[model samples]
Target: MTIIAGVALLLAAVAFFLLPTAHLNTRSLVRVNGVARIVPPETKVAGLAELEGLQTGPGSMLDLTGDVTVLGAGAPAERTLSGRPLDPDGILPDGARIVVRHGDHVLEAIRRVTVQIPYETSVEGKGVIVSLVRPGVPGERELFKGVASGKQAAVFTTSAPQNAVIERTSSAASGLKLAALTFDDGPGKFTQGVLDALAAKHVPGTFFVLGSSAAGNKAMIEKIKAAGHEVENHSWDHPILTKLTTEQIMRQISRTEEVIGGSRYLRPPYGSYDAKVTAAAAALGHKLVLWTVDTRDWETPEVGAILANVKAQTKPGAIILMHDGGNNRSATVASIPVVIDWLFQQGYSLTTVAGLL
Candidate 1:
């Protein structure tokens, strides 16, 4: 009996040594911030302190209320557990992803941008002879932009734009019995007839020729010049000067100047002009010339009506508008002689616009 009891006791001791304890059986495998770690069975809930010690390298204990410095900017740090906000003493789960992000801090700054200010024009005095009283100047303004870190800027304040002022003065009518004969859109087929009429009467006139037309009709331009008539700019293709930008206006005037070798006067198409056109013309040393009388010759009016329009509108220091080209100008070609004769008969001297001025 003693021998049997000894055997059973020995077997019981062996069995107790081989079986696992409750603490060892409850051990769990968990990931802390993507790292594998073994949590002891005694730690039912884990916090930042427990995770900090589990980290491979020595690091500061997680501070819930401290600022984090990132890329020269300081802001509060945010802690998360598995994509959700982590409480100061929250439970940590197995296979959880932990993330920490710094909140961006806002900063204020000023930004500057340049803006173009167009000039303004003020015309004074009367009559056809115009002179510049004051030249124009361009101005600028300041724009203040408010910006925040990692955000778009907003405009908070802007200075008013300063506009340049330009002034022009004109002379009163001279009251002398003198009228200026001006032709437009010319250097074409009917140009010779008009030139012959002016040459026969020994009178000087102004011919405002288009740059395109002048480039193609070089001989006609030469004839107009040789006949003692003034050759001026009528633009290239005759666009409304007011409708074009400043650069476009400059191109139109400068191209014409280059083609005709330059002129001091420009007659905008359809008698159109504005502050921008005036400034552009002045930049190239050209002056704007407009007519005091309209013959409406472009409408193909009757020769008698054309002559009558001339008779009524002709006055001292007047610029008479006519066209030698641009379509069906036979009536204008026929009225040339009669217009000159009546002007002479009415005791009006026929001369170029420059001469009248």
Candidate 2:
């Protein structure tokens, strides 16, 4: 073999041997019950803030932040850059920060917490109930896990409540007199404007809020209600429902409703759903209402694109799709006037989804 060829082979062998042994001492810790709890490396962690300036060396420190619980939500527990847990196995909140030390680097992390759901049915025909309680110190925040065991053979906990239902809704309007407008994925900053626009036009519409967004903005949610628009359930995380289990589907409905807790009618995210997805919703007394018109405002940021999409698609009894949240909605908001004006010119009367059917 040529000398260069032999050298290449030698380097390849050296890299293969060295790569497997290379690993930074990465830590995964969270606040539980107001203390920093070091989540084992084996635990799955998808929710953590970027630890840009944290110290992670032998002498690093970590400070607990917020409510100081191990399982609560929001802001990482603050930690000084030190290698030691100030009070090991202590409680910490959802957003608490922690520090670890490795040489001169102080490693840091924040709790990436998601709400735990109760009593979800799996797609495979099984039941799951997540106990808000997890084994931890006194006053430790409750922990949430994605995959929960069916029921503890040793003991079972109480069940969650059924989702709220729309008791008596107005008729789905006769002859499509007024064009009822509907917006999904909202409660965003622009939501107020959309509300204002509809109010100006004397139009009543429906808002399908994603569950997670609802939790983040309660004031806006109340405003949507106060604005006289119907608030309805969107999915929990706005993921494509078909990929999730029946229980997950219910969680999408229940969790969204978990926040809104009332107001029936749900428009699926991305117009995404299946028959099974519907059954999961029916179990919660939610009716699946697919939009007859999709403005597709989510596609381009251009207002013209939004207007064209809506103008091309909207028809009578159409549950036209637009959004007020989930990324910038300037385009969607811009298109509203175009669609409404056109519909009005076309002699379509505006009404709310509840009013429509």
What's the lDDT for residue 146 in model 1? 36
Model 2 CA deviation exceeding 4 Å by range: 1-178
Model 1 spans > 4 angstroms off: 1-113, 129-132, 144-173
Error of 1 at 120 (Å): 2.8
- TM for candidate 1 is 0.63
Whole-structure CA lDDT of model 2: 0.61
lDDT of 1 by residue, 72-183 (tens): 3434456666777766555455455666554545344445555556556666644554335555555554444433322223333344433434343332344788888899
Q: For model 1, where is the 10-residue window of minimal lDDT? A: 56-65
lDDT of 1 at 151: 26
**lDDT digits (tens) for residues 1-357 of candidate 2:** 699999999999998777843133244466533456654343322222233333222332222221222222333344432334445334333345555324432223433333333323222221110111211111212332222221112222233323322222223553455446778887788798788778777778789888898899988888878877899987877899978987888888888887886756777776665555666776787776666566777778787877777678665566677888877887776767777788888888777777777
